[model samples]
Target: MSDKKLLLLSSSREGQTDYLEHALPLIDGFLDKSIKNVLFIPYAGFAMGYDKYEDKVNQPFQTIGKKVTSIHRFDDPVKAVEEADAIAIGGGNTFHLLKELYDNELIDAIRKRVDQGMPYMGWSAGSNVAGLTICTTNDMPIVEPRSFNALALVNFQINPHYTDYQPPNHNGETRAERIFEYVRANPHRYVVGTREGTALQLKDNKLTLVGNKPGLVFRDGEKTRPIQCNTDISWLL
Candidate 1:
């Protein structure tokens, strides 16, 4: 990827609880201070808590003097993503996010935009798209196929929401476990299991980790060996 071309802020959870704080700066970094146009798409919210999550999110950008316009639905979503000096897709369930992207032909459009040099930011499912495959996401196939094909923005795959926590009320396998099984079966790709507050930042062929703690990179069924940012992501790339 070109320098500063794609800033991925993949979080393990939803809402503004410090997640936005970690994500919003990437937007500000991309703000073309001279230009008044910046497009923000909020469709991932649709799959999560619905419009209930919108205002709280749209508000912070306003306070920062960032011009943010929002649209929901499969209707012309790509146009909004295509023209932004920067674009951010909020967090939500990957299944619904994929449906919206596929329905609107956004999968192809996003790949095109990034190629044309648009800096795109995605939290949660949005971040997963930057990888070559959606196989690493924590989301289940609640619907049909859902196109395992992805944006292919980076050669590596992302497993956001990569928590190793197991709450008493928690049901099913932990996100980390799911990814472990995935890697066990297919031993090629390097998967980053990002815990909450942790993000994989990619810019201009440079990839770095910022936030709460260091992330884990899994390969051949073993825990990661935490490579440094200056190393071209040798584990994954």
Candidate 2:
């Protein structure tokens, strides 16, 4: 746990902000200056090809004076992870991403690398996979992975892109109700509902919620609580 460095974002864009524009500052600050290149995992990007995904991410990374290389470009993806200075996983479909990771056998490789103090950052579905399991993700199960278990980068579950808003005449289950159902079945676990534009940063044995909006914390038999921005949530660790 002491060796882990993570930046888990709720979403890639905030309302009308440009792609990766809202997160550039946090991304730049979270990554060490010594990291010249970031290994990118674009498995979640099902609509666009990996090459296009790489190009999309590079657009903003170049602004920060860093380069991004997608793992799909490498002959040996596992070796790529082992040798990367840092890694970033982009958002798309969670199930597809997890399946590809399992199929390529990069799960253990990535977990091992991050455990060795390599910086890891992700957004949306990418952030969903950073938790103990992908059960809390909002994406529908379009594909199945080897298992729902994920990287376990963080001990608890994460509900990224969280929103409590229920539109008029919309009778669908609210996000809170959905999360309540999850905690009811998995009582001991904690789920952090990271709102749009928010991120969770873990460094120096402390976890800080980043953003202007407040996040939510959920557990069985307990009232949901709001986690203020810049608050230390290392207790979840």
Top model by TM-score, which number?
A: 2
lDDT of 2: 0.95
TM-score of 1: 0.81
Query: How well is each residue in 5-72 modelled by candidate 2, as lDDT tens digits?
Result: 99999999999999999999999999988898999999999789999999999999999999999999
Give lDDT for model 1: 0.67
Q: Residue 74 of model 2: what lDDT?
A: 95
> For residue 83, what is the lDDT in candidate 1?
63
Clashing pairs in 2: none
lDDT of 1 at 229: 38
Estimate every model's Cα lDDT from 0 to 1.
0.67, 0.95
